[model samples]
Target: MFRGLSAFPLTPVDEDGVDLTAYAALVARLAGAGVDSIGALGSTGGYAYLTREQRARVAEAAVDAASGTPVMVGIGALRTRDVLALAEDAQNAGAAAVLLAPLTYQPLGDDEVFGLYEDVTHHLSVPLCVYDNPATTHVRFSDELHARIAALPHIGSVKIPGVPTGAEDRVAALRALLPASVALGVSGDWTAVRGLNSGCDVWYSVLGGTFPRTALALTRAAQSGHADHANDLSDALEPLWALFRRHGSLRVMAAAASHLGLTGEVNLPRPLRGLDAEQRREVVAVLDALGLDE
Candidate 1:
């Protein structure tokens, strides 16, 4: 199973579309920073915006970049058949695992939710992570239901999004209820300092995809019980995240990566827009102050 610090690497795009060279460079940087795995075509990758073929190219690029490290592909669709097809795609592509959320458009009952997972587990042999990104699905994961699903034969982990209200309590409950072997990860890098303090075992940090060395330093500090250092690093990021909070941030993050010389292509699809000039100024100032841009 993919564990420790992982990043959902954005798939780079340009006029030619799906910039493979840029995507590989992004993955190479993440791997060098010691990220455990690469998440391709997740929300960060604009999975909903990509065609099936583009998703395949992104997945192949990620696995190929890792060389030996495991790569995970996000299967973020509502239909059971389609998700299974994506899961099979991940398996064939040599991904370490598949990440998923509840059905889209319709609110699935807990039983139906469970059925989706059960069906997915049966259809695909690879280990899968239950992605409770209620921010995307518009339904929250209940503690009661989480306890019930921890024992399913094929589940390898659970990925709770960073936007969970009262996330401290949420992670605590998971620590209290879930089996020790079923790996638990938090996707909220903005509140990662607090999440680490809450005893969350895995930090699947999205911010690490930007300033990876700093992210690794923060993770190492947290792992070593050096909360003081970790908190300091988190403090350095407060301004950048504030800019991210100022706008619809799916594109802002990709832009932030670009401004740092990661890539100049911030090809965001519709329903999301790039950061305005003011927000970009704020990001640059914050990175400069942190010596991150240096």
Candidate 2:
């Protein structure tokens, strides 16, 4: 369940609290595309912005819409108590696994971070993926820290940020620290090809959420050792990657999904606006140029 392409769909929302209809449609689309797993409430899913009840509903909706494809729900929260609650909700909702990042308000020490995992894992009935997303969570995981956490029960996978292109050594070094049972998945859509080719076990993808076919092609090509073909596939989507680099994957994907009529015009939560008209026009052009809209 932890390996291969794990598509993280955006949790589309509007004036109505949790847009379950639209969000479920997105998950159904991903499952229909045959992604290895569906990751709900991940960063791209706007998990951080949602309330506990909203997230619980999203988790239930994703599992229902996934059509038996393994669903991994994000259970990250600033407080360990909330994380535990979210984890329980996800497990009860039939999530195959839970993704937890050490979400922070004040800076957390390594011990505090490890303790958070220890506390949650002790009560978890399902597997947990350690989400090492420094860009959003502000809490970074050292190799030693990761080793410590992965040793805990229920630690099934570790989702690391993008491995630099051609940085096989980095992946190898991290893999060496993890238990053989713990899968190493990569995030950051732009670096997926490099990360996969470098020997990561899974792609925890933002792009896969909205563009599963394109992302899957790239993932399969790399996983099959067709390095040149994978690179070519990634190059073909360079414009989209550029947009992701420029405007962030969350916003670009929300815009692209809206353009594709997969979700509403105002899908993001409050304080987070979708791209303006001009940026969206650029996205459309890129989608058209790459034949991604087809």
Candidate 3:
């Protein structure tokens, strides 16, 4: 189930809210191009920005566009009950699963992390995938936390960030303890092959957002033991990554969307920041070179 290309599509909103046409077109484009799954409200969708009620409405829109594809909703609220409520909303919207991120800030003890999982999983029937984007979430999935989540009956697994530097040996040690059923994958492309080679069972990515065809190609190549071929596309995708590495991805992506008329307001939450005119132009240039502009 965690095998193919999965995209995290942005939530298309305007001053009036919810641009169904833009949202539908994006979903239809990706689904038609062979993206195996779709995740709404993931980092790509600016999940943390939307209020709970707004997220519910946006999620409902996603489920309709999902059309039976494995739609995963990012359920990342600071509070446990609200997270569980979003998971319920995901289920209600027919989402295939909910992507849960651990509570951020205010450090959590091991027991607290496990308890959070137990609380959310209590009301969930669909599978739950944990997101370990520690840059924002602030807590890494320590080995003990991984073990606890894997033991849970409903958590399918996690989308952990790239393994930490100097942690390769530790990952080799850790992999032995992780169950095959609880798979792991990172979120970027150049790193994706490494992740897959490192025994991550799936590839959940934002690269899939603009380049689903290329992303699926990469996944197929890796799965077929053609990692070198995947590497070639990763090279082609380097410019996109460069945009992300230099400034930021989510903001650059919003600018790209505005450039393409996908959304009117390319806004990030307060203090998240955006690229200026010069930086935006550079991003558009890269996208233009990639033939990504609409």
Clashes of each: 0, 0, 0
> Model 2: how far is 97 from its true place, Å?
0.2
Candidate 2 per-residue lDDT, tens place, 110-144, comes to 99999999999999888999999999988889999
User: On TM-score, who's better, 1 or 2?
Assistant: 2
Candidate 1's displacement at residue 120, Å, is 0.6
Which ranges of candidate 3 are over 4 A from the true structure?
14-16, 163-174, 265-273
lDDT of 1: 0.74
Cα displacement (Å) at residue 34, model 1: 1.6
The lDDT ranking, best first, is 2, 3, 1
lDDT of 3 at 250: 77
Best model per lDDT: 2
The alpha-carbon RMSD values of the candidates against the true structure, listed in the order shown, are 2.2, 0.9, 2.2
Task: Report the lDDT tens digits of candidate 1 across residue range 1-294.
Answer: 445677777676654577778888888878877787777777777777676677777888888887767787888676888887777877888888887777579778888888788888887677778888776788677877777776676687887766335767877778788888788877766777777656666677667666667777887788788888888888877776676566644666777777867776456665556777777777777778878862
